[model samples]
Target: MAKLENLVQLLDRSLSLHGPRPLFGTKADGRWSWITYAEFGQLVARFRGGLASLGVQRGDRVALISNNRVEWAVAAYACFSMGVAVVPMYEAQLPAEWAFIINDCEASVAIVATPQIYEKCRDLPEKAPSLKHIVCLFEPEGPDGAPGARTTSYGALLAAGEKGPAPAIDPTAADTACLIYTSGTTGNPKGVILSHGNIASNVCAVLDLIPFGSADRSLSFLPWTHSFGHTGELHVMITVGASMALSESVDKIVANLAEVHPTVLMSVPRIFCRIYEGVQKQMTEKPALVQGLFRAGLRAAARQNKGEALGLVERLTLAAADRVIFSKIRDKFGGKLKYAISGGAALSYEVAEFVDALGITVYEGYGLTETSPVVAVNYPGARRLGTVGKPIPGVRVEIDRSETHDSRQGEIVVYGPNVMVGYHKRDEENKAVMMEDGGFRTGDLGYLDEDGYLHVTGRIKEQYKLENGKYVAPSPIEDKLKLSPLINNAMVYGDNRLFNVALIVPEMTALSEWARGEGLTFDSPGAMLRHPRVIARVQAEVDRCSSDAKGFEKIKKVALTDEDFTAENGMLTPTLKLKRRVVLAKYAPVLDALYSGSTKAAPREAAPPG
Candidate 1:
């Protein structure tokens, strides 16, 4: 088995592989860009030298706050070669969050893309007491009103580094490579210190499952702040000598995909699910004959599932529908897409199975940022509709809290080289978590089936108890509710009361437009949410979903959220997972009103505990 001696090896090997071919593709114009592995190497070398000139030495923490630009990738490579630990901050982070992470990571120098990003934490030196410099990655017009304290332009750094003597570098796998801060469910972020080997081992192991070639082209939209995107889309592509086209933004991905025709696609569940929802909405509005055709195609699919022999007529009908209808749907995502992988969140089987039915293979990966993010993935080699496939080679997965069946179940704990070195400088904290022998306990709950394939349930920490002492897992319940195209995101509560309730955030664009189509009047998501007909529609969908869940798990009542639960508002983590505690706290009053019977449910909130 190939092992990662250092995470930076990806940079060395990638720069060496297909040296004459393009490695990074970006826009020189609306639809044009250029790349060559040789040029990539030169850029990385310059950045490294520049950082060195600024007194950034081995083991120094380098903070990078940028949008997804080619320069960001180059900065990572340069830091790796210099053996400087890099910390990626989301450009999407609020000002306070940006400051907190800089201080917590003890970042010495920063590579920022824009002045606004610098201003977000302009006072970092006072707060961190470790910051030495801030270098802007983009062109500046006479400093562009930047803070004058210990800040320099990227151009100057490049010039200085070009003349600076290269520092002797001897990085190893065990040394810390990067500290990725997961926007915590609580107030501050936790810096997950991943070693070079931790990331490198997973990269090499992944090569065992995915075969990448020179012909492969990837269009990336997932942010580099995420581990799944950092390693899976970025490093793995470079490791394999394939070309990558940087996606402009998530909003432009479909158009970008069509232009790039990526051979491999990586995405979140929300993306695929929205695409499916779009197709469904189209079908529902189609002429009766087209609707009939779609139904027939689905019926045919049902009859010939699981490698069953297909009737000739049925096959022909399905084939015809694929060409006429499904082909257009696939074109939206680029017709050349061989397979798409879903990670970072749970994908509904309804969406997964439907995508598979359409001749596009969809695989789901399960992991946390702490696990170098991939513990198990549902690949074609051993994929099932509902399970996140067996642990990848060399990774051990255990789901705790098994119901005495020896089912290999509970919060999934992983033991592998890919596991993190632990949170930075948090010795007691690290000792409390990482097992002596290297196992890291993942708080996510799950179980392994007979085949050893891992299946994630919900977060053990997210579980809540009811007034009667019953506990409920909100994930599955929330997931089921989100399948309603109108419901963008849902959070379930009701651990202590008589039954469960929910705070539903309707997909305002979809819901308002839907209401308009139905002749309902509304100016905002809130107005649309409370319309009698709109409420009835949502309630009906909720009821249908509820019938399937156990009573305790069902959402007996619900309130509408006027705005989105986002990171800036302290309701969601950076990954977009609802912070159960935060959301519960923020929405307590609304939940009270829910229990007070504004939702008009039978189980009203009982009197408060004294």
Candidate 2:
């Protein structure tokens, strides 16, 4: 394929080459539907014309709030072809966040998914004065549940465009294509300004490595609002003329997987973790002989993956297990999954190995939103167990040892065309992450191994994304907990895991007074902390403090300790700041137990503290 100057060019090329090929697959009324590339191209052109009728022009911004749908794709491409930037927000995000993003980006139009969402955002214009139009993908219902009001439906937009087609303006490589908002440590989300060239270069570089083509199909559930899903899955698939089946919802992914028989799956670590857990759960129900065979096969596969010589007996056992056990697991995935691309957060090595042993290659990659979300990835020919593979073409990576105490690893600095122009309008934040030589400081601490594969160690920034790829900034939540007299100190812990848990230290004096008021008795501090009543009380405080937090940011579980982090304990720095690594290391077991359904601070017996 010719070098993609912009995303519009990519769309046009695919239309010319694969006009009759299926481009999008959508599910509705318990049935699957497909739209061809030519049909998609025509829709984009009409949508662009409709947007123009509303006075949307080059350099203007359109805010989109929806889950993955055919209309969402149409709106995005339409905006991109007109040199308009699309600001996409997650449907799962709070309505307040949507308003903030709309105002921040000064969006001229806001396109939402459903009538319910429109109801939530109807008052947004009062808050976001820049927003002039609110277009709903579905028509809004009146008091009797029929089509109502002036809210423009997606179909209406297409009709308007068809009546008076707007010419597609080929955007330059440097024009901003989208603003992807990601959470920061202390404040509201910051918009990462990615240009057309930034994402196009990433897609082209990834296409050169991965073996996706027109025949490949993907069941896409990952939100395109995320850079990984947008550029990596949506854009990359379009470039190669691959079809994508939009998953109905997260709960229906498995059913859709079987129905679509997709050749590719682009997802975060959480999805793979669920698949591994499901397989393990099924194995527990199998006969002893089958379970033994499965375990032996998995062990042999692991050894082989490590390049260890396999005995003839082990090889035979693996082949038998593949036919009897693994094949069924693959069948649940429709037996057509060529490979899965795991990104957004670090995937567990065990999960990757489990999927690989089942004949599905899981190509793990690492990147941040600031770098168009793809720095390095393991592909077909080159893969390592723990490391994200070598940097893609046109990307340069260097380690800044001065940022870390460990000589072998440091902050990863990247320079590439894929790098974003900068965070929108945040010059100070830009200066902090941009290097003197134009390299972007990745904030992640990692190292390149002897073979040039990158091994991610840890993060320098306290902000982290959970296994589900939702970013959480612990300090703000921790600070809120400490505000309660019941909580003397708190540290939220959930990085690359399903949900958030916290380790909290109680105010001993206040706790004792409360215990006395409740007529509770206990011998030691640990015993007092472990009392069910005390645990419930502290949990109440946590609930009260985090009531306003986003759903993902709220603490799901808690572990209590009488031990306070102090300078002497090395959990606190000389400046009285919490040393997160030290705190996590000391309380790792207790915190981990919370996720395993063992509420460590809740006692088995009815013991009271006084």
Candidate 3:
């Protein structure tokens, strides 16, 4: 409590000073239960003692494989309390990936959410030579048999700690707090070594900019394994005494929003995109008069967003529109959301504008896992519509334009307390990304404006040159295509080819509505994709979205699919980022056929307006 220096100290201060205050809310048996600060602290202490009893000494590594839950928080803080470096793995990741991370980090103890997750890593002790114990959060059970010799129930471990001596707590700012493995789009994931100061720096910086406090509450659904969710949502909320509800799943976000009526929401671009699409789809179903009213509300909101003073008549009309239209939109998000934070990916300009017009401000931020996950974010008073705002205090960002033709645009290099120490045990990988001045080369191409707002353009590695020698950034084009309500997810491919082609995943709900209107019937998504009418409709949407793109960047041919790219399918990362390599490999046949002109669909060419 004496001027907290490390993450453990922060947790202690929160417990002692904010005693008896409800910190976390979790649902069970159709009811919500609250865990107070003091209770949470006691649990952490017990868990720490339990871990220490199992020979989890200071500087030892522990791995946690779990979805977001109250116990996950308890386990993480317990690890930090005793100077144990927590290695968090996405529960949805392949078992092989899990084994690799556990072994790579040399974790000694593994804490998993359920028996099922433990089963995935059942052979981890053999795979990870250092692994000595496996703790299951749920009641101890094993898949198809009794619990393994090394396996113990979470409650039993806590009970062991409750009878042991108090856990030790002494950590320096430089001590590693967590090893968060990156969701590798290019290769195997690397363990990003974030020290206590690294994460604490980001939490303090964000708190300085945002007015979050005890009065605020949030419903959290972001995966805790991801740095963005861990440092940004959980740690930040805990640091400021904010209450959080552990959401059940992403699919239940809407229901949870209404149930919690949370004051703050943190999410990725996909959520906003889906919300915008749902709203737009609903508007289309409304009568012309209602649609006109919604449009008027949006116009007035846009004017106010631009700082325009409304005349008396305009103000009155705006008030009426907000009452009838915008109010309902707000209600869907629990009617009390102060603002939403968008990160994890580049939000489409259209989605941002549309959400803004609905009177809900979505602040966009930019960062990678290596920077404690938050380099820049748009604060309330100093936000630019499309740009990710200025760097946080103590963070330095410079554009390395040496390799780029454009002087203003280049790779973003960051030097700050939030930057990771280095990739754990991967010196060669660390050297490649680390600059002489200690800055981390982010590999994201972007430019800072005169106002200091950072505008991300694309991923340096994702950019590819066509056969005609024209370079195309697929991210921007994919983002643009997703703005259309019909398209949910898109992957652009044209590397060393004559032109770009795409694999598009349709928004099934919106597509169903349109199909119903067109008198189209299909038993399945695959059948729908094969229909000529459905194909032509999607083609028109692609043409419209690609109109502003460069000739070489335009999507020439597209293969539609009803299947969405998801973490389970190995097509998307846990954070919802598309895994380009996996996607291409999965759809190799379709892509090859698209390029060979063996498909019946005609290739669309991009031409300038007459």
Candidate 4:
């Protein structure tokens, strides 16, 4: 393959090389449909023409609001191919967020997924005066369902494109290809303007690290609007000629896994954690003999996964276990899964180990939107268990020690072609994040080990100080808490307080089963949370999970809640990351009670089983 100068050239080369190969697949009406690379290219050309007919030219911004769908891919590539910068927004975000992003980007054209999305941002022109056209992916039911006067159906746009001239534009690698907004955990989202070269460099570097080919197929469910999914899965898969099946939804991932039977899977850690919990839960219901065999297999595999030489006896035992036990676990993932890529958050070590023991390699990488989302990743032969592997080829990573109080680790900074130009129109914000030598300061606190593996500890901004002047990193403790099957989500509190405390969201399914076994009954989620038995059980789990933490880091008190923080509730980002500030504000009363010494009930004697 030639060194592609820009994204458009990459796309053209890919199409020429894999024109007849299946590129994308989707399920509709209980059937699977596929589009070849040639067909997809044609769709992109038509969309490009359509966009051109709407006066979308080079340097123009086109905002797209949609879930993970074929149209999202088509629109994004169309915009990239024509030198128009894409601004992707989560379809489910609030109207206010949509308005803010649209106005901030000064988008001239908008492509929406459905009438609902169009309606959500119909008044966008009032807020974003630059926005001139609204294109809907699906037709509206009636005039009332139609968006503002500027809106047109996606089909109509394509039909008009058939009569319009193909857009003629030339773009350099430095030209902005996309503007990905941050999830805005601490404040309003800022647009990270990634250039064509930035994304192309990342795609090329990642390809050199992770192996993919025409034979590989992937099931993609991660939100396409996010950088991780956009660059890692969509762009990487397309560049490599691998087929991708668009999942119906996140809730249908397990079913789609079987139906798609993908050779590769890309997802966040939460999905893997849930799979680990589900597997454990199912095993507990099996016969003792079955459970014993599974545990024996897991033990044997774990030793091998740790790079320990297995004795002949252990090797033979593992081979037998693979046939009887591990193979069955692999069968759940279509029995052909070769690799699973985890990113978007720190995958728990336990879950990663468990999946690796099942004979599937889980490569956990780390990056940010500003870095075209891939700075480091664990490849097939160079994986480290606990560390996010070495930086991809051509990227330079350095630990900045000046800002850290501890000399061991500091902010992880990057200098690479993959790094974004800067945040769009936020010179002050960009100045704050950009280092003296042009390195993008990743707010994550981590250190590089002797072997060059990156160990991300926690977020520097997320660290909090206690009344005793001890600074605590919450993510590490939260990761531990989530390892407990009884706990789903947790937020560690106590910034400038006596000791660390946590607001925990119980794994309702597991908790309900335990409650049933204990003869406990509750009508509502709030009532269940307030129950003495539930609180006691949660506290015990919290203590057990946080046992490895230092004295100051251990969670002293906890408040249980049945409500899981979600993006819809403003407690989590669209990508499922917790919005710490939002969560703190939402749970103010609970935190106050814990610190004020009003809710310190002793844990009951009967602790839930692991």
Candidate 5:
């Protein structure tokens, strides 16, 4: 494999090597549809010409508002080939966020997924002066030929491009390729200016290590607006000539998985967590003998994972469990999922083990959008259960211990070609993160072990100190808590407080089912959560999950809520990371009451572990 100079070269190489191979798949009329690499190349050419027809020239930015779709790829590749920077915004994002990104990037054209989105964004130009044209992926209600008041259908642009095709122009590696806005867990999202070299280098490095070939397929649901999905999945898959079946929606992932039978799975931890919970829930409904056998099989798997010997009985039990229980579970994932790449957040160790035990190799990686999203990842032949794998080729990982208590742990600083140029137009902010030596200070706190695997501890901004001055990294704790089926989402807070506390959102469906089985009656989800028996049960779950945690890391008290931290709720990023500040502010009274011991916040203080 030749080294990629830019994304254009990457695309061209794949097209040349595997032109007739399938590149993308879409579901329509209850079946999966595919587009070959050569056909994808043609779409890129037409999209490039279409962008050109809209007066979108090289160096200009184009805002894309859509989910994972073939057209999204078309527009992105077209921009990359034309030396145009793509500013991708999530469909789940608020209109104001779209306008802000568009204005920030000075996007000349905006391409949306549907007419409904078009209507919402048609008036964006009123606020975003640089946004001169808006194109809809679906045809709008109008005439077929000409543009409509600065808005037009995707069909029109493709037709115009076909009439006057624009030849592919490979941009220099140093040129800007995309402007990915951070999920903005705190303040306004900063646009990370990633160059062609930045993303291309990441894709190349990843492809070199990961053995993804033309035969592999992925059920794509992670938003392309995210760097994890954009560079990790989209560009990497295209470069390797692998096919991606775009999931209809998050709700349709399982259905699409069975239909697509993807060999490779790339997703966030939440999805994996749900799968773990689902499997656990299902097992509870099984016969006692079956449940006992499953538990024994899990013990055998754990022993195997640790290179420990298993007894003949355990081995037989594990084989039977695999054949009876695990095989059925694996079949749900199309029975062909060989590798699952977990990024965007730390995957729970339990979930990772569960999936691996079921036969799918789960590789957990760690990176931020600023590093073109992949600094280190676990692959075959080099994998650790708890730690993210070694840094990719050409990437250097260093830990700055200036602020951390531990000798070997601190901020994870990354120096690599994959590092972004800078945050777009935020020089002061850039200076804060970008080192004079070219390394980007990933605010994430972690340490590279002697084995060279990176263990991400927590976000520096999210980690808080207790009254005793013990630093608590809430992410690991929160991740463990959510592993319990009773807890949907959790945020740990105890900055300058006596001990850590949590705001937990009960997994409503699971909670409701549990309540029904326990013969507990409640008028609402809130009432059920407020029940003493329910609180005691949930606390036990929390305790069980955090059994191995350090003294300061355990949740001393918790306040239950039905409100899930979601993108729409303004308490979570589009990538599903908790907005600590937002969540803390919203639940301040409840959290404060936990310390006071006299408030009506329904904060049940758990007895300290003996």
Candidate 6:
């Protein structure tokens, strides 16, 4: 850790290093607008001026409700410039969600990413009366804009900024810089207070891994509301002076990749997994002999990756396949893609290896929102497939001493400068697990290998045992099940039974096509799940999921579910992580029906392993 005296200084220094370069660039209605290093400096001044004009003083709380966009970054810069703590809530939040966050932060100013979000806050200011200014990034379509009837567009705010002087914010590292809410599965989200030092330090650690500078081009699509998007990509991009593509939507990621050909691409596992699936679907259109050759080549590549010297024939076969088949797949990533930092969740092992084979490096890392979001990562030159690499420079990691686990694994813990100070206003809760020595007990269960790599086995809170008293790690089963094209999602059950069972959801698009080819018909395709053909096919897939497992952990039965497990249904967190407790309660009836040992039922319809 380069002991930073303060974050404001870090920003100043970084700007000096990357000065007036293309700090941000985005398409506005098919036209591109860019802010250079010098322009970026002026904008920071303007944002500060705007905040001051709105009567925001140092240490005042300002809440930001927005989606992922370059404009959000602008607002963040504005808040930090004045040492006024910024609270960021996800755009997916409803009116009530914003109300909770606004009340918790006691914000004096709320910046809505869109007019839509401003509309959501209509009743908040009325109820809380603490909120004052409402800044809008876009004209969101909604019933009413932000509370207090105080709404101003970014353009209007910047104009207001021009009329005021820059606020002199001589802030220290100790000052609270941001408040990011945790995606609560059980209750209202907790405000995680991260000081400027915490975030600045964490981003510096990130820079050590992702080798991009002002010259390197990057695409920003991850939601700024999330730590991974904020700290991992945006912060690192800013520090390095990397040019930002600033995509308009996720649907345009492919086009952006082609248009910008970014050097640094960051995304969750789902994006890559879908790409891999799409590639495979295309290959199915080729002649049988050609397809067989490609498969043979892929197998040979895997063998070569494992360090086995391929026979001349195998090498040639794979080389031919790569040049003709795989090379085109690589082109889709703009043919200049370098670092693909996968986080937010584990990228599928298959997805990781597949990308690696195409000559693009996909580095996997692990962290939580609490630890300023990054504790460990695999740099380009430093990587291992089965592990989330060692602690980043300055972060200290230790397995929890109080962890209760079987001999094979224990809960993971960490300590470092990257750790957030504490949960806002939750001293009692903070005192419970955050140790006096600074260690934070991560609820993830894993054991460090002799090489110091962390391998998370399962969640400590999600553990369940079989009838034989042997524990089952649902994650492994979940990952393995997702490997099957027919299996979109699966939750392994069998807490107290002889063996495990699973609740399965299929990918509707893929499953629907299969149903059509089988001459199946119904009011809705989900009803075709009970057809003998679909049952037999799904049964085969279930068998495949349990094939490599021991009897105790093997899946014996499974029932197909119709609906997708989603955050709206309380079965998933906003991060797309499964809420095991919520899922079980929501689908208790399905579990009971699946285990009832009866074969008669209608498939209402159907859902991936993470």
Candidate that scores best on lDDT: 5
Candidate 2 deviant stretches above 4 angstroms: 142-150, 463-610
Query: Clash totals for all models, in order?
Result: 11, 1, 0, 0, 0, 12
lDDT of 1 at 320: 81
lDDT tens per residue, model 2, 1-610:
4578799999999999999999999888889999999999999999999999898999999999998888999999999999999999877666787889998899989998987788888878878888878788986565422122136778888999999999999899999999999843335779999999999899899888988999999999988988889999999999999999999888989989999999999997668867876788678789999999999999988888767999999999989999999888888898899888988766766678888888888799999889998999998788997678889988999999894556798889999998889998899999999888889998887899988898876566886889998767676577567656577788999999999999888878878888989999888777888878888888888999899989999898888887777745556632234778777766777788888898757221321221
Candidate 3 lDDT by residue in tens digits, 1-610? 1234578877876777677888999888888899999899888888888888888888999999998888899889988988889999887888999889988999988888877786677788778888888888988654423233277778987899999956567789999999999988788899999999998888888888888888788899888798989999998888878889999888888888888888888888888888887888889989999899888878777788879998887787779888998887788788988878889889887788788887778789999899998999999788888888899988999999987788799999999999999999999989999989989999999999999999999999999999998877899889889889889888999989988888888887878888989999987666777777887788789999989887767887888776678888788887778999888876766766778874433211111111
**Each candidate's lDDT (Cα)?**
0.77, 0.84, 0.84, 0.86, 0.86, 0.76
Query: In candidate 2, how many Å is residue 426 off?
Result: 0.6
Compute each candidate's TM-score over C-alphas: 0.93, 0.79, 0.95, 0.96, 0.96, 0.92
Candidate 5 lDDT, 446-524, residue by residue in tens:
9888888999988998888889989989999999998887888888889999888888887778878888999988876
lDDT of residue 113 for candidate 4? 86
lDDT of 4 by residue, 407-480 (tens): 77999999999888999889999998898787999999999998899999999999889999988889988988
lDDT at 510, model 1: 75
* Tens-digit lDDT string for candidate 6 (464-581): 8777888888877787787677878888887887777777787767777888887877676556666667766777887885688776777766777666677676677777778777
Candidate 1 global lDDT: 0.77
Global Cα RMSD, each model: 3.6, 11.0, 4.2, 3.6, 3.6, 3.1
Residue pairs in candidate 3 whose N, alpha carbon or C atoms collide under 3 angstroms: none
Where model 1 places Cα greater than 4 Å from the true spot, the runs are 1-3, 143-149, 165-170, 298-305, 402-408, 509-528, 600-610
lDDT of 5 at 573: 83
Q: lDDT score of model 2?
A: 0.84
Between candidates 2 and 3, name the one with more favorable TM-score.
3
Better of 1 and 3 by lDDT: 3
Query: Which regions in candidate 6 have their CA more than 4 angstroms from the true location?
Result: 1-6, 29-33, 139-149, 303-311, 599-610
